[model samples]
Target: MNTRPIAAGLFDEGASPRLRGGRHRQTGRFVFPCPQGGERDSYDEVRLASTGTLWSWTIQRFRPKSPPYTGPEAFEPFALGYVALAGQTIVEARLTGMAFDAIRIGMALRLTTLPFATDPDGTTVLIYAFEPDGDRAS
Candidate 1:
């Protein structure tokens, strides 16, 4: 099956998975990757750091509101957190690999893709996440 991102420009489609962002020409400020300037009013494509530290997190014991969620059924607890990318944007993503109880602040993490679900056309939709780089994503 072909692997595809949940959304285009979410991560690098290259050999290594690094978050993609845009650097504004006007202020050198960064924005989440996209065409014609992503989040920023104007920008140039830039590759973001893959390694980062867990800044903060929480165990999501309940399912989120619908519409934009489309979350899992039966709602198993999952950990979500912000990863501080040095000298760049801090991304908020789902934390995986380690158990929810084991998630700790300041833990080393690396960019990795997680399988979300398959589309009607049979393509696999993937989501990005920060997993413990201790070994799994190392």
Candidate 2:
């Protein structure tokens, strides 16, 4: 099946994916997605760390309102959280590859992807996510 990212410039398509972030040319601060349009001129595109620590997270139990939520009609709970990429910014993303109870703050995590949706043309749309770095199944 053909596969594609949910959005362009979000992450690199590689053996081990890395999020594409932006570093401020002047301030040296980083942002998850490199800005667009004229604002992009002030930032330099940079690949972010592939691993991070789970800072905080919560279970999304309810189906989110539409117009944005494009998942299956049948809803399922999922975990999401902010991962601190060392000296870089904390990124909010879906947490996967483990059970909810097994999740813990400061747990080591690594960049990954999950199937978000499929287009009529049969293209699988993938979204970036974070999962436990090593085996911690419980």
Candidate 3:
């Protein structure tokens, strides 16, 4: 099936996925996907480092309020966490392939694209997920 991001610029299109962001031209502070406008309104697109340490996390067991969420009628609990990038922003994303009890602070993680859902038009929408950093061969 043809795949596409849940949103563009969330990650780079390449052999490996790299998170994309915007950096403030003057302050050098970064924002995920894009940057918030400043007084001068200067910003530049930049690829964010894919690896970061797991900061903190939680499990959302209930369906979130509608109007924004458009998932299936049946909801499944999932892991959500904050990852601290080195000298960069802390990103929040769904956790994958890790047991609930296995998550820990400072653990290594890598950004990845995971299957979200198939759209009405038959496009596979992929969302970002942070997984335990390691070789898949292992």
Candidate 4:
């Protein structure tokens, strides 16, 4: 299972799992591993969320500089963008599983987890992405 909780102390009201330095039940803080950024201790707050609009986007014509970039070299075109979450901090990520022609500015988007690819060393890279909100992408 994708143990990395998409929602943790974020929506849950409390003394704050992060502020208290306690491990979050969903995303896991002090202990367990986070599939997204991996086991250290950065997801200590609500830095990102699903409630963002498609502020802007662009199609990349070349492969990224890392192994996790799995888009076909022949294809040479993929979407990436900055998702402005409800609060501060903007999440830079790829926008996929949708058609470029249909994507537009100011569209509703939700947070999603995407499996990039396995590295030569055998570590699976997970990426945080956003997808158009079903029926609310306008």
Best by lDDT: 2
- Predicted candidate 3 versus true structure: per-residue lDDT over 1-138, tens digit per residue: 788888866776545788887788888998776754463367788888888889999999999887688666688888989988999899888899899998888888988878777899898888888899885212
After TM-score superposition, the amount by which residue 63's alpha carbon in candidate 3 deviates from its true location, in angstroms, is 1.2
Q: Give the TM-score of candidate 1.
A: 0.84
lDDT assessment of candidate 4: 0.55
TM-score-wise, the better of 1 and 3 is 3
Model 3: residues with Cα > 4 Å off, grouped in runs: 13-15, 36-41, 135-138
**Number of clashes found in candidate 2:** 0
TM-score of 4: 0.56
lDDT measured at residue 104 in model 4 versus the true structure, 0 to 100: 82
lDDT of 1 by residue, 41-128 (tens): 5677888889899999998887878767765556677888999888878888888899877887889998888877678788878888
By TM-score rank, best first, the candidates go 2, 3, 1, 4
Candidate 4 weakest ten by summed lDDT: 12-21
- The residue-by-residue lDDT of candidate 2 on 1-138, one tens digit each, is 688899988998656999999999999999989898989999999999999999999999999999799887788999999999999999999999989998999899999998988888999989999999886322
TM-score of each: 0.84, 0.94, 0.88, 0.56
Q: Best by TM-score, which number? A: 2
Q: Which stretches of candidate 1 lie over 4 Å from their true place?
A: 33-41, 135-138
Question: Model 4, 70: alpha-carbon shift in Å?
Answer: 8.7
